[model samples]
Target: MNILVTGATGFVGRRVCARLQKSQSYNLSSAVRQSGSNPPGSEVVIHEVDGQTSWQCALKNQQVVIHTAARAHIMNDEVADPLAEYRRVNVDGTLNLARQAAEAGVRRLIYISSVKVNGEQTPAGCPFTAEDAAAPADPYGVSKLESEMQLRQLAKDTGMEVVIIRPSLVYGPGAKGNFATMVRLVAKGLPLPLGSIRNRRSLLALDNLVDLIVTCISHPNAANQTFLAADGEDLSTTELLRGVANAMGIPSRLIPVPAGLLQFGATLLGQKALARRLLGSLQVDIEHTRKCLNWTPPLTVEQGLRHCFEIRQD
Candidate 1:
């Protein structure tokens, strides 16, 4: 199999490349952003991905393209017209690459989207599913949703298979953003006020997500399907903190702060979204993914956390 993986230098991309390389089965080609950010096997160094970017050179002889490159979602962006900035890369760039890949006879293109496409929070036990109507709440989510629509249409128009995988808060080795911050705080034995947060949030282990992506590559049932990927186990903020403490073999240092008080403070600070994220439910139902791809997360939450923290020490 001739597989081309975009975002080769990214957290998930690097792991995907490494996992694929270890197998020594597929002819893996990694598309990196810069010159020196190589990932083992064959490399295609594309400086930037945008509307005007050309991918014909890279798409040649590539059978399956795992499109993982995109402008990551962030709370604060220092760019003017954040929406345009998002569209430039996420929307325009992805479509351009897809179009070229289709023309270049790429058989499949798997898009790594976000669970944000299904909306921010789900009602208590009602997890988000692929059947749910897309309700993107942010510029990044909107851009992703737009890209998904385009990809699906391109799949219909051209005979290229497009697999969409939306993963929840991904965590593991080399993880970043909120999850990384939480691990660091727990490791430092700092008092975290998330004990009172009874919210259940879904998380996707990096290995689990990579496993799903790899499974989707050749799975006939995965063609033209949008799958929500997660570890199948949901955890509350308090439970998560305690789990991290247990995983680290340290005492759980958490304060019982009221959710209402936290929300109030966040409101005053104009961070209501951040507050909801900390004290709300955002779960994803991976039943469809399991049924469709015959896949299950290969690692438990504890195992994934251990791999992460252990790697952090090195």
Candidate 2:
């Protein structure tokens, strides 16, 4: 099979490319922006992703396209209109690639979406499922939802297959953002104030996500389906920190601060959003994905964190 993967240089895309390359069963090509470097052992096609970007060259002779590129979530975006900017790159750019892939006789397109499409957070003990109506909470999530809608329509109009996977809080080696920050804090044995946070959040390991992407590429029942993926485990903020500390062979020094006081302090400091992420529940139900695809995460949360610590040590 011939496959083209966009954002091949990104954290997730790099792993996807490496796994596919090692399998040695398919011909791989990478579709990257003009500024990105090509991964070894794959063909590279360069194009800007915007309202006017052309994907004809990149989509040629490709059987599957796994799209992972986008304007990722920014804590404080300085753009005049963040939503419009996100739409231009994420929504418009993705649809353009899908249309060109269809025209080039591509078989399937796999989109990497965010669990934020369901909502910012779920009620305690109530997980978000794939069947729930989309309730994107931010500009980034809204853009992904719009792109998914458009892709389904495009798949129907053309005879192309589309598979959507929404993953929550992906973490592992080479991870960025909050995960990276936590890893650093744990490595240094810094004190944390999240010991009282009882909220549970679902997370996806990089290996698990890559495994699911590979499965969706060829699974017969994956076409026209949307799935939520996780490690089949949920952890509270304090528990997650302890896990990280254990992985790093360090003692956890967590102070039990009340969740409400923490939130209030964060609000005063303009970090309420970050506080919610730490103290709120955002769980996902992957029962449908497991039953439909007959799949399970290859690695457990502890094992994944161990691997992450090993990589950090190296």
| Candidate 2 C-alpha error for residue 301, in Å | 0.5
Alpha carbon lDDT of residue 81, candidate 1?
88
lDDT of 1 by residue, 240-261 (tens): 8898888788999989999899
lDDT of 2: 0.91
- What root-mean-square deviation over C-alphas does model 1 reach? 1.2
Candidate 2 collision pairs: none
lDDT of each: 0.91, 0.91
lDDT of 2 by residue, 235-263 (tens): 99999999988888889999999999999
Query: lDDT of candidate 1 vs native?
Result: 0.91
**In model 1, which range of ten residues has the least summed lDDT?**
32-41
